[model samples]
Target: MSSSDIFIGETIGTAILILLGGGVCAAVTLKASKARNAGWLAIAFGWGFAVMTAVYIAGPLSGAHLNPAVTVALAVKDGDWSNVPTYFAGEFLGAMIGAALVWVAYYGQFQAHLTDKEIVGGPGAQSTAAKSVEAQEKGAGPVLGVFSTGPEIRHTVQNLATEIIGTVVLLLAVLTQGLNDAGNGLGVLGGLITALVVVSIGLSLGGPTGYAINPARDLGPRIVHALLPLPNKGGSDWSYAWIPVVGPLIGGALAAGIYNVAFA
Candidate 1:
């Protein structure tokens, strides 16, 4: 594909991917929504469906590489580097745009959810009543998870390892499945199978750091979270940010190396 094709395809594809994926998060997390408190199974399946849909729609355009990790892995596997920057630019831009769309879709719910006066107290939370306005400004609210991932336990080592291992599984599956065969993009069947793999990873490995197997998927939305005008949206959790970015890159590179050594 030409540079414009790559850019436009990835931009639209990643935007659709995040719209559905992040839409699911908003559906389940935000109060006043019908799907609120739907649980993890719902989220896993929702994200999987999102992947399948986005891939089918954008497969012919940009190979449906909504995730930066997948783009890097393909480059590594094929020994090509010309389009890496293009893929990343489109992916991040699409992600941020998708996230912004999510906020718009759930504007009312977000207003109600974030402005809630109910006090939140627990381990890692300060003991006090719900100070929604203050919490939003100080970046100490629970709303960040809706837009990005955070460790349940806050252990850097384990969190990073989880993301790395999870991303390795993702990239390895993509490489070994022969999904890259098509001149157009991930085959229709390849898209379905890849989406299933994503669900599997979420079901089995998503407990830690929310299984951020894609760098753009995490950082781009996190950037939106920071910049958006949401009320009481806590800090973007920048401290844990590098783990998602670094771990996935490492995992993708490692997967490529392993594929070259053993599978190629």
Candidate 2:
């Protein structure tokens, strides 16, 4: 495919990926949403469906490698570096756009969730006490979970390991199954398989770090959370941001290496 096609496809696909993925988080976490407290199973399935939908939509235009890790893994697997930057640009830009759209979609719910005295601890209260124990340990503010993932425990080693492990599983499936080899990236069956893989990763390995198997999925929305003018929205947890970004990258390269040695 041409570079323009790749860019547009990645941009559109990744945006939809984040919009629906982040939308579920907003629906479950925000107070005013009818799906409030819908729980983790809902999130896992929601994100899985989001992946399937985006892949099919953008597949025709640009093979729909929505995640930067997937893009990187393909580059590593094929030993081609030329189009890496284009894919990266599209993924990150789409992710940011998608995140901003989430804020627009959930504006009132966000306001209600953040401004509640019980949630944000009233006006002028900057304390972390109102946040969950995990958020407090991670130094994240209330409502940040809707925008990004945070560790339930603050162990650096375990959190990074979880992300890496989950990503490896995802990339392994994509690489081994030839999911990206189609004229339409991740064709019908491939999209469904990959989506189910994501759900499996989230259900089995997401407990520690919320399974941020995709770097763009986490960091782009986190950046949005930091920039948005949500009332009383707390810190972006910058300290922990590197794990999701770096861990998936390493996992991608590792998975590619394994594919080269074992599958290729």
Candidate 3:
């Protein structure tokens, strides 16, 4: 595919991904009436569906690299350093656009359901509100709240480890799926495998820190949450933000290293 085609496909695909992945977060967490806490299963399957749908739509044209780590991994695997900048830029831009749409699509619902007071409380309260809304909406038996970082801000090492492991699994799966195999085109089988990988990561390891396996996925949406005119939004939590970015970069690089040793 041409560079233009790749760019367009990646942008649209990433937009759809964040729309669905983050949309679910909003749907369950933000919407007051119909809100339902999207458990690990929901998050896992939502992302799985996001990947499946995005790949189905854009994989043929752009390889559907909605995640920056995947694009970086592909560049490293092929030894093509020149396009690295362009691909990363494309992925980042796409992720931002996608995240923006997710915020927009769910903004009204989020506002309607959640109070301004709830948003300003902190990330923990904001997340809790989301879970409460989701439970009420779905009429679920009981709301399941998953807390990672507390208000006091302890457990730096644990959070970093969580990010690292999450990113490692994400990149390892991409590498194993032959992202660079021009001859091995991605079909339904490839899509299914990718979906399963995402589900596995969420179920087994997403307990701490909501498994932000993609840097762009977290940072981009967090930016939207800050900039968007949400009534009671708390601080963007920018202080602790570097861990996700740095951890994922290291994890992706490490996964590449391991893949090279085992498969290359």
Candidate 4:
């Protein structure tokens, strides 16, 4: 495909991916939403469906490699560097756009959740400034999980390892399963299988670190979380940002290497 086609396809596809995928997080985490407290099963299946939809839509143009880690892994696997920057540009741009749309879609829910008496301020509660300060000091944030992932335990080594392992599974499966070679991109069956793999990873390995197997999926939304104005949204937790990006990348490379060594 032409560069324009690749870029446009990835942009549209990743936007849809994040729209639905992050929409689930908002539904589960945001207050006043019908699906609030919908729980993990909902999130896993929701994300799986999001992947399926995006791949089916964007696969024809860009192979639907919406994650930077996936793009990097594929490049490594194929020894093709020409289109890496194109894919990255499209993915990141699309991710940011998707996150912004999510904000718009759930604006009211975010406001309610952030300004709830329990979260931000109350008679016995801290002021917004105090909350922000305290959260920064503690390296914590509120309502960010709707947009990005965070660890439940906050163990550095273990958290990083969890993301890496999760992403390894993701990239390995995509490399081995995706029919990116056939037709324009992921075949219909590949999309379904890959979507199931996403759900499986979330159910099996998502507990500790929220299973951020895609760098763009996590960081783009995290950036929006930091920039978007909402009442008492708390810190973006930049301290923990590196792990999700770095770990997934490492895992993608490892998966590609393994695929080349064993499966190629």
- RMSD over all Cα atoms, model 3: 6.3
lDDT of 4 by residue, 91-190 (tens): 8888888989999999999888877766665666657546545665665567778788888888999999999999999988888885466535768988
Flag regions of model 4 displaced more than 4 Å. 124-137
Q: Write the per-residue lDDT of candidate 2 for residues 1-49, one digit (tens) a residue.
A: 8999989999999999999999999999888899999999999999999
Cα lDDT tens digits, model 3, 9-122, are 777777787778776665665545364665557767887888788878878777777777776666666676665555566666766777677656666665664454443233
The candidate that wins on TM-score is: 2
lDDT-wise, the better of 1 and 2 is 2
Which of 1 and 4 is ahead in TM-score?
A: 4
- Judge candidate 4 against the unseen true structure and give its global Cα lDDT, from 0 to 1: 0.87
Candidate closer to the true structure by lDDT (higher is better), 1 or 3: 1
Error of 3 at 185 (Å): 5.4
| True lDDT of residue 16, candidate 2 | 97
Candidate 1: which pairs clash?
119-130, 136-232, 139-235
Lowest lDDT block of 10, candidate 1: 119-128
For every model in order, what is the number of clashing pairs? 3, 0, 5, 0
